[model samples]
Target: MNATNSQSPTIVLVHGALTDASVWHGVIRLTQAAGHHVVAPSLPLRGLASDAAYLESVPGPIVLVAHSYAGSVISHPATLDPKVKALVFIAAFQPDAGESSAELNERFPGSKLGPATTTVVPRPGGNDMYLKPEAFGEVYAGDVAPDVVSVMAAAQRPIDPAALGETLPARATWHDLPSWALVSTRDLSLPPQLLGFTARRAESHIVEVESSHAVPVSHPREVTEVVLEAVRCALS
Candidate 1:
């Protein structure tokens, strides 16, 4: 039932802040049903360098896909693995060399992920940030079912505040890799305008979907289609 050939790239799905790899559940199911091998890894969300290094360790010949803050993770120079053929960003950040996710998230005016919407918990190394359960649906997944949003909010993973401020390395993988982006028109966590700007700045092929920042969850079919497109282009 595998649709991919031996030469086809593996799909590596990276999740972002406030959520874990489970965010890609539907996308993984769809992608796998299409016969492609897929891996959605839980990022440490400690900082950009460490997170990128962890992602770099995944076996490759990969079509790397990232969501929200994970855009910064996959774009790190450390992830410039030769086997990584393409990058797919889903309502994600695509920070430049000196840019940080925090900076980019502020570039446009629409993000509702500020202090009032989130809670800060002091951890051993740094502050951990979480979206308040009440704010999760409106800010991160407005299009998703209330019941599903409830579980997502309860199971959400907190990310180190430091990770949002860490800048990318001097070089970025998008600088050399072919990339595609899916911009969520209804995203409130990362402004849709910010997403479009970053996507164009990377010269990435773009697709627009109507969903929340949790596009992978609310619109998995669209996300999977974009990933499959990247795979097709990479194989071509």
Candidate 2:
């Protein structure tokens, strides 16, 4: 391959709370099949600042893909970094300055997530949380198979409460970069209208799908297509 052609921008996938990088398994497979480099790093789910810093540490010129709460991370330095060429949000939170995942979760009227979740104190000063296993399948991954949802529920990560309430920095790459979004119409974790609000605010190229919040797992083809679109934009 010529040097120019060999230099495809890397696709960095960031997973949100209640799930680890494993959530992007299907999306990674499809992106890799399309001959693009892809990496899904585990977000700490401790706080947005730490997660964003971790994402920023990756060498860039990357197509940054954020799922769920991760949208908040990539919007900042994760996208603002000079190496980030474009951004793709898959049913993710995209908060502006002074906004937060906790705030946005209640911004619209469709989400049933808050009541379904329960918290556990991970330490003396803070807490970590997870969705009730019974509600996990219906709310977060409705389109996924039953067996898979069972496995996902068993392995779901606990997100630190700080991550959700942490306010964002003053600036975000979405405010200035080329961006694309996959709006999951069936998403109960982050409602479709809420996703629409964020995507429109960022002026992102939008594609709507009838999947749940776990769109990467339930609608990998759709997620992959959006990622490829961002990759094409980065390459151009």
Candidate 3:
């Protein structure tokens, strides 16, 4: 990891399935206000390997922040990149080699997400899974305003079912790098227990918050604080 210098390291934010980069907007503003370089890229919800390959293209030596499924993406090339100094997971998954996210989601099985989603959309490569518009507020963003949830649901991106079932790469970056994880206590999409399990498995410095799966959106300040902690460690 690079020592603290005159310039802050770049911070790349990765969003998970059923959402786009816009989900990071709240956190982006907080990072920007703190004078850090931030980039929240949209991860195509095609599959894990492909998405990681795409994220690997970003110039790194960065503090990588990943939410939900994007957690799997950052665990590969981006996390392994010498340029990547720290990893921050926000109510995200941390699957190991040979482990599939679908299985992980069912590992504890307390999530309301399965029932909240619909798989009626047929895409080119595979079926697209989406959180039902009516269920979005209750399942994904319980703490968010109704109006905001409305907009989020309308703009929601459907994830390829294949992505959810994709096994992780042979290797993972979190195994080597220092990591921080934020667990949303109120999250129904990715249960807090599952998040805690993954975080502990990764040996991440963890903090729990009373928020939802959309913690980055509903509690940006807290999320930014954790990201900043990883940044501090990266530069130390």
Q: What total of clashing residue pairs does each candidate reach? A: 1, 1, 2
lDDT score for residue 175 of model 3: 91
lDDT tens digits, residue span 46-103, model 1: 8889999898778879999999999999999889888999999999999989999999
Structural RMSD, model 2: 2.2
Q: Indicate the worst ten consecutive residues by lDDT in candidate 3.
A: 1-10
Clashing pairs in 3: 61-83, 61-84
Model 2 TM-score (2 dp): 0.94
Off by over 4 Å in 3: 1-6, 77-79
| Model 2: CA > 4 A from native | 1-5, 77-79
Leading candidate by TM-score: 1
Give the C-alpha lDDT of model 1.
0.93
What are the per-residue Cα lDDT tens digits for candidate 2 across 33-127?
Answer: 77777788887777888888888678867889999988998886544877888989999988888898989988898887875465455765677
